[model samples]
Target: MKRFINKWWRGRIAKLDLCPLPKALAPLENGRVLIFAPHQDDETIGCGGTLALLRKNGCEVKAVFVTDGGGAGGLPEGTVAIRKKEAAAALAVLGVDDLVFLDEPDGSFRNTLGFEQKIMAILDQFQPDWLFMPSVLDYHRDHVAIGQALYACWRRWQGTARAFFYEIWSPLPATWVVDISSVAELKRSALSRYELPLAHCDYLSASMGLAAYRGLYLSCNGQSGLAEAFVEAENNGIWSGISERMLALRIYFEKLLKR
Candidate 1:
């Protein structure tokens, strides 16, 4: 039954018209991009292809790890150290050398003013031309917190950078897509570096599946390869719904039910 549903879902997605996504997000010469991940793997799982492409185009990319992934259960001791090493290796694959670790408590990201200020400080310091983060609707509590925190800062930061939201635990209603076919293999290889997490879950396959699902939204070559999806900050209503505080309350309860 599950297999049938999966196939049906794929077919239904494939038959839909191309989603209204812009062209691939390539970085300008010497451009800068900053990405925030609730955990180490989310960055690679979400936009590894885009990062690789940006680096190849002489873009300076920095990834900020919001948590150490130590909060996840069923993991061996020293998992945090292991994941950091894995992340470094993976980023190295894309020629990315700038990495930041916030060391925030995993599964406990509160959308507080202090937290927002910390993130805002980073944004003001980096002033990256492109900012990427987990989607607020992401099922993971940390993902939602970081997304909402960044969203809050974005409301005040006058920087010219464009913000985008990515997905991992849950698929987002994407308003933009990046053709990742060329870097698909690289993205897969990068994801495979996480031996610790891969031992627990086949994240490589899952990442590929999501990327392929996004590919189905493309018209070129009739979905030949992987693509990454994102929702532009201006277009996404993760905060501007009914009321920000009310929406937050609704999402909090919805998250509880989903759990």
Candidate 2:
């Protein structure tokens, strides 16, 4: 069985493009990390492996679910409660208990001044060394809006958190990748708690596939492991990064308007 699994993984690895290896994240000794998820399951989907590693290395980690997730899965009346419960269970499995559910409405996340203030408040309170958020290029409107709002808040507050963007509905051009091979099963266990999402889309398989692809990249770089990928940037570069993205968006929309 083990040999068969190895053969299959190697076969998958063989087809992947071997890009320059992503920088490996050093384990935190006593650091603080924060994650902003547009919805409940994104935190687990995008960075569960890193979260597990952080906990294992004694890093303080907290997650903020920006939306109540009530607008998804066609069960509005009970969706929020169900998803939140699931998220709590999932995070608990990762040894993460400090969760903050912002309870904002899903699908209509705003990038307003008030929203920025709310995000800034959390930044003020946590002041994490590392902050992770959904990538701005994510196809989901809520994900994109939350990412923009968080970046705006960081600009205002000039918070000290080093920014990293995680992928979900879109893949980031990752500058760093953390080998989560050791904690692969832990990530699976955490994600399995999202019963509703898993029922709709086999997120477990999709997410694992991405991780496996990243692992192949790592292997090509001489590391035999699975990985979670991210676009890492220092605080100084965040505003510029946001500006570049906004400019491109504006150009695209302007062209659409001309049409």
Candidate 3:
């Protein structure tokens, strides 16, 4: 039954001719892009390829790691410093020089007033054309929290910045996809920098595989390519509806992540 539904849904979307596969190529050059990660490695896992593509197209890119990444999410204690180092190396491969570390608690992100203020401060300062964050439907609590907080910040600020939500532990209902076949190797190298986290989870292979899957049906020829999925931030009515539905199941998801 699930398989049938999935096939029917794919078939329904396949008929569309949105830029030849729902591809978004706006502001492809000379744009400001800001990305926020719940952990040291989430940035790379979520949109490393898009980061590379953006830099290649001359976009000013800034990445912010929202957590210390220590003794949480299966990582060991005292690993925060090392993870930051790893992040520097990984982002370097993507040609990202501007980085920020918020040093908030790992696996424990609350949408507190202070937290929202910090996030909004960056929005005011950077004034990014594109803001990258994790998807609210992601499996991890940290991912969801960061996404929600970012959403809330945008709500209050109501700035011109556009939000692009990426997939990590959960697949997003993508509004568009960015072809990253040109920088697939760069993304692979970036993912390889985090040896410690790779040991815990094979994100390199998983991310690459997901990218391939995203590109498989959308590619021009029979050859398979790599792409990254992004769901643009919806308007207030739609976004509020989605958030309310997700929050209704917060208790269940929290228990699942904790266990």
Enumerate clash totals for all models, in the order shown.
0, 0, 0
Give each prediction's root-mean-square deviation over alpha carbons: 7.4, 10.2, 5.2
Model 1 residue 195 lDDT score: 83
Better of 1 and 3 by TM-score: 3
Judge candidate 1 at residue 129 and give its lDDT. Answer: 90
Ranked by lDDT from best down, the candidates are 3, 2, 1
lDDT tens string, model 1, 1-259? 9999999999999999774544444445578999998898899999999899889888989899988778656667988898899999999987788999888877776676776777888888988998897887777778877887787687688788888888888887677778788888889888988887788799799889888888876764344567898877763475466226533764887868978
What TM-score against the true fold does each predicted structure earn?
0.82, 0.84, 0.84
- Compose the digit string of candidate 3's lDDT tens values, residues 1-259: 9999999999999998675445544336889999999998899998999999999999999999998888455655668988999999999999998999988998777778888888888999998988888888888888888888888787778678788889998787677888788899999999999988898789799999999988864555443578888878765788788776765576577788678
- Stretches of candidate 3 above 4 Å error? 1-21, 24-27, 73-77, 220-224, 246-259
Estimate, for each residue in 1-259, the C-alpha lDDT of model 2 and write its tens digit.
9999999999999999875667777656678999999999999889999999999989999999989988744675788899899999999999899999888888877777677777888888888888898887677778877876776676667667788889997677788888999999999999999998888899899999899988876765568778999887555676577646753674575578679
Of the two candidates 1 and 2, the one with more favorable TM-score, higher being better, is 2
Q: Against the correct fold, how does model 3 do in TM-score?
A: 0.84
Q: Per-residue error at 135 for model 3, in Å?
A: 0.9
State in Å the error of residue 145, model 2. Answer: 0.8
* lDDT score for residue 98 of model 2: 98
